[model samples]
Target: MTRDKILVVGANGELGQALLRELGTEKAIAATRTANTPHVGFDHVRIGSDGNLPVATLKRCAAVINAAGSVAGDDQTLRSANIHLPRVIALAAKNAGVPRLIQVSSFSILGAAEYIDRTTKERPINAYGRSKAAAERLLLESSSDELSVECVRLPFLFSATKPGLLAPLLSLTTRLRYLPTVAGNPVRRSMVVYADAAKQLVAAAQSGLSGISFVADPRPFDYALLATILAEEADINIRILQVPRPIAASIDHLLPALGRRLLRSSLLDPCANRVGDEPLGLEEELRKLVRSTYGS
Candidate 1:
């Protein structure tokens, strides 16, 4: 009997690569815009310039996991990748009779919600968030008896292979004697290790549930605690300085570009809190991240 093929779009991306590693090469096919990518030794499909999945390729797969996304891009680029591409894929999957379509979405759509669940209303504050929210809406709305569509919303992800948002924090802790933070050290936002998140995405695809599902680490650490954990693990000491939120917000407003960058860093102020299965705790996650970046 032939094993069902799983086509992973944006297979070269961090989440896409994680899925490839989790699903293994035998059952997975990598789809990207360009054939030349770091992910080698796997079957690859090239996405067309028109942003449509090839029908022939779609028919050969059991399911299509769209991990394609962009955190940094202009409005047009964001919409094309985050919104248009997913819609195109959904339509193609339905037409090809693909049984399952899992879209990897982000927590950015939650905006400043303190707690997020399956029923939380999305309030996107920026172009990236807006695009993702729109994509999720489009895909979920398009689901029918013939096609199974679901969106797995993920929080900040870190892993040995992908440092993600941790890279900047690691740099700051090691380089700076003092790290500035909001006046009140806010609780750390929700996050999941890459491997765990990858497994969750695969599980969501296999499950029969439809609509939005969130995946995150069970326990979240605040900024100071996270820095302390990293510092201890790395054998480096750094001081934490608290700055007023209004002042920070003012600075951000004054320098719009810089503020946007900082907000993405998750260093500004905690907006939404994430809740999910925590296979690995904060310390363990930070330890793995530090080992990957600094070497034990």
Candidate 2:
């Protein structure tokens, strides 16, 4: 029996590679820009310079994963990958009778609302987020019965392959036995590891789940617990020193910028509907991430 074919755009990218691993070659066809991409021998769909994808092949796809995007680039590059490409894919998918189109987005689109929900309007702080917000709007507008377009607005996604914010901090684990964090850090934000995000995206494709969806652990995330996990995974002392406010302030500059940013209060409301699930909780995901990155 023939299995469902999922077309993964940006097949050479971090998330695209993750999705390829999740779906495997038998089920997924990687969409690359040129035949000369790193993926030399795989089922390929070469998107054109004009943002035109071959609609004929798209007709056979059960789902199209619009994973092509740029996290950092010039304005034209961001618009091309994050906005125009998605619009082009959406129109083509609509015409090709594709059942689902899963577009990758970012939580940055909403900026730092004290608590973000579906009702929250996008107020991106950076060019990347702005591009994503625009892309999401275009995709959602293109959604219809024939083509269900759902943009997975990812938060702090990490993995061994793409360590993201975790790389520098995790490296510090080797130098410092215990990380000194602000005591009673209560900030909770959406987060997902790369593998899980890929799995969740595949599920969304199969289920034809549509609309804008924020992603990550739906439960309360504890910074102290996360610090411990990072320490252990990095093969350092698994002690998280929760320094008091007065003490923390004396050396708060020691904290990495990303670390300070994370400790700040910004959470997605628990009631807000999101896509990815963290059945094993955020701690386990962190464990998986560090282990993968360190090859431990």
Candidate 3:
């Protein structure tokens, strides 16, 4: 029997590239805005011009995976990339007779929820979160017998190739002998290794499960533990100074921008802390990332 063709949108991104690596080049069709050169070790099609998706290409795939997102765009750009793009893909996939649509969504949509699961309601607090929530809504509402949609909500993802949030944290911790943090250093948050997340994404695409599912590391860690682990691995000594949360909250209240940033930080206010069955170990995954990136 012949294998079904899978289309991956935003095939040039970190998650997209990871998915391609997991799924292999033979079974996947890479779609991006520009097909000028090879992408993720595969030839790709320029699926969109400006802001519109290529309906013709979408109609030909057996399944579609949307890994595209806008992390730091203005209101209009955010809406277009996060909301409009996914909406278009869902409609085109439905029209094209595509059976499965896997949307790589974010944990930001859940905001500061302590324990996030499929049943947890979305309470987006920022523009990016709102846009992602809106996109997820559109895709879930658009699901049908012909087109099954699944949204995989992911936490902070890290890899050697893409350090992501870890890079900054590592830099800050390594440079300072003493790091000051809010009182919530023990607040654990969900995280996943990029390679592990890719496996889950591929499983979701092939499993034919519908609705929302969260993929995360088996264990959650707080800022203090994270700093200690990094310091020990890097062979450095650092002290963590915990300030009062009330003082930090007061400062945040005085400065709106800082308040927003603080609210978004997983260390200060975690969104997800639940674990799944046979999940990856947090320390093991962190060690892999550190070894790959820093060779320690």
Best by TM-score: 3
Which parts of model 3 have CA positions greater than 4 angstroms off? Answer: 1-3, 37-43, 50-60, 179-185, 251-275, 281-285, 288-295
lDDT of 1 at 162: 70
Candidate 3 — worst ten consecutive residues by lDDT sum? Answer: 266-275
How would you encode candidate 1's per-residue C-alpha lDDT over 163-280 as one tens digit per residue? 7656876676578766666676444466777777787788877778787777776666455665676677766667776768887788678986545433323321223222334345
Better of 1 and 3 by lDDT: 1
Output the lDDT of residue 128, model 3.
95
Clashes in predicted model 3: 0
Candidate 3 similarity to native, TM-score: 0.84
Residue 255, candidate 3: how far off, in angstroms?
Answer: 5.5
Clash pairs, candidate 1, are 188-222
Q: State each model's C-alpha RMSD to the native.
A: 3.8, 3.7, 3.6
Candidate 2 lDDT tens digits, 73-153: 899999988999999888888787887999988888987565777798878878999999988888888888888888887
Q: What is the C-alpha local distance difference test score of candidate 1?
A: 0.75
Off by over 4 Å in 2: 1-3, 36-41, 173-183, 218-222, 230-235, 238-262, 273-285, 288-296
